[model samples]
Target: MDVELKSLTGNGTWSVVSLPKDKKPVGCKWVYKIKRNPDGTVERFKARLVAKGFTQQEGVDFIDTFSPVAKLVTVKLLLALAATQKWSLTQMDVTNAFLHGDLEEEIYMSLPPGYTDTSSGSLPPRPVSSNDTAAEEALKILLRSHFKIKDLGPLKFFLGLEIARSSQGISVSQRKYCLELISDTGLIGSKPVTVPLDPNVSSHKETGPTLVDLTPYRALVGPHMKAAQRVVRYLKSNPGQGLFYSVNSDMQLKAFGDADWAQCPETRRSVSGFCVFLGSSLISWKAKKQHTVSRSSTEAEYRALANTTCCAPDKGGEKDCGADFSKGHDRFKSSERCLLLDGDDVAYTEWF
Candidate 1:
């Protein structure tokens, strides 16, 4: 507690100012969590002072909330390149990164324990952890010169994901996080399934009991929380399994896309998912519901293909063909360094 407070004070997060006549400063609370290692070991205990952002009125207390964050695809892309080039991937942590950044707009806080506005959901080494070893090192020095950062040494646990390095390649997983999720939802010792979603339980969703609680379904959560639990169970079964970027993996970029036509019972929107690979290294993948309903399967497939192509931006080089494609709502394409996809949206494979 003292350490956390000292760090906050040293960083100039907020000062104990005199209470104004009319200002009602927002209240703050301390949040705590236990960090664990990939092998189910306790890593460290963390405590954070957070303000009740819910109480603050938008456009009054704060104008706009824009958090600069990196997509998961970026992480996968870096991992893929590291695997192909056999580069050493290290992870660093900025204890209070958001507190250091210069905000565009100004906002004042009330008395008592003043609050520091948070930036994003989680930290995943955005603008860091790239393939270029020397460039990355240079960046580290520059960052150290500016902000107070701790070199954790070798990327191990990051944003709930566990990373392990070996002679063959680097492996990444979220086993610890999955188990915690299962425990949180009270699904311990439950039978695991092969897929993330259980088809039988989710089938015939025309009449399902509505969950009244709204907090549970914030993110990766829903009305029943069953889907989240099911995903946790699936992850439990393959706790140690994760992306394996091999040392011998080639740099050939390829992508695949597909979609489930009108699969959602509640929403008529079709589902699109896709995955991209560099040689044999799986770099990125996405699965999401379509915005609009497609009239025909071909139309849905084409939309998915267009999405894939857009995502598979050219990495400033020529790509060549690497994978075979099949008919009926499936597409493939490749970029110089990345591959693009749509509903059931993914891979459009034509190597430049």
Candidate 2:
């Protein structure tokens, strides 16, 4: 706790202050965690002094608060692209992520420096990683000169996702996370399934039951709980099974998607999912039920097709995703990529 306070003081997080006319000081507490390596071993002990931000009133302590969080999908997509490029992912400790956002809110620095001063904010710890050797080493030099920092080595357990590297490619899985979820829900002895969801389960459309004791685990409640349990059972069956991205320059992107029209009798909305591949390895995949209902099966298939075009570009930003198609998609400026629909309902006048 003493060390945490000293670090906060060193970072210029706050100053010794007296309570204002009707205001109170926010309380803080030290949080400890056992940081571990990728091989399920203890790496180090971490201590962080976090403020009780939840106790603050809306307009009393601050107006608004915003924290940036990285999505799991983006992480996998980047790893897939890295495998294709034959680049390894390494971790980097950044001093401040909200260097620009701190100017608007006074939640960071004790002293309000001039407009030119950019290093006043007390941004949260960023465990970001990169593949570029030059840029990463350059950043380390910059952080060392300004703040007291330490290197945590190669990327391991990040945001609850385990990363494994090899000569062939990188493998990512949520095995530990899945196990913890199963143990929390007391489903260790449950039977395994080949897939996550049951196709014949019609109760998914209606509210089955409410789990009064286990509401925090949303996946373990109501009709969703059964499907969630099935997913956990499947994870238990193949805990080591993960996305294996191989090193190759194929760069050819292939997309496959399907839609079940009016799949949910509860909502009448269609379900669509797509997986984009960079050569033989699958890079990204997502399943989502449409917000709006589709009248016809073709419309649902077309909606799924629309999602395929946007998935690679939105998720895989740094890569030359657009170049994969080359002249194959030249004529498809308005709505690019060829669409292949399943079943016999392949009737479209404008396209195909």
Candidate 3:
């Protein structure tokens, strides 16, 4: 595909622009990728010219780098909802996503190799004049006016989520990518474990001999995370998996939360976990460490419960007003209340 420059003003024309005196233009590079199907067939070849965003400065080049992304739970919930509602799910991709975002800051980027105006032919470099600020602003306006960008349209691929739409519902899968990761790590031939972690065992603060070679550990953790993410992909693989909703049940939203006290031996911080369900189907779940240190298991459980309770849409941020008790009794009371509310149908367990 050929890159065309359009006048930002909607009129067709090219304009010469000057560069800023203080700011250095970041470099750009072209990335190439080959799209393939699960059946080992080539789908298409794609190329993207991207800016080196890493080189950007925080205050000068840009601020507020935070970008909101749909959480994993959100993604899974959407999928489950689609399956339950029997609605079709489709996937589309925007060819160049970053290019669509309007540049907010006065940023300069290096001209792509072989795409620069070579006719300017080894022109002598000129020193910045006294009125450099005004010149820079005028230059930016001219550059934006000359280079017209085209939106590649809808999104077909995102991250690694492959989407497929059908009459039953939308299926998201990443079998191809998952298999590639498995193969890359030589884990394809390894035995498959039933659980992501060993429930009986716990990780403790190890003050003993440290790993002499950290490379292997980094490699191991890297692939493991990739596999966990691929769980979403596998779900997509079988878009028809058993997430269907039935008209026979009430759509009550329920949640189960628990915590392990002093779970991190080094930090003495508890690990909190919670799962939310719409009817019998789990819609959201989380397992994470508490930000603050808890004095006891009971306190940890209480804190975890508070965190889980906040997940409820109606519950605004409110401090727990219940009376306090001794460590043992408080923990028992917390667990008892949690179980009583959840009943035998739902399972929530906590231990220190």
Q: Which ten residues in a row have the lowest lDDT in candidate 2?
A: 327-336
**For model 3, how does the per-residue alpha-carbon lDDT over 76-95 read when each residue is reduced to its tens digit?**
55554444544333332222
The alpha-carbon deviation from the true structure for residue 36 of candidate 2, after best TM-score superposition, in angstroms, is 3.8
Tell me each candidate's TM-score: 0.75, 0.75, 0.62
lDDT of each: 0.64, 0.61, 0.50
**Candidate 1 or 3, higher TM-score?**
1
lDDT of 2 by residue, 274-319 (tens): 7776666676788888889999877787788777657754323543
RMSD of candidate 2 to the true fold? 6.8
Say which candidate scores most in lDDT: 1
Give lDDT tens digits, candidate 1, residues 40-156. Answer: 778777777677788888878777787786656656666766665566667777767778667664334443243343211125443345557788889899979987767777777
Best TM-score among the predictions, by candidate number? 2
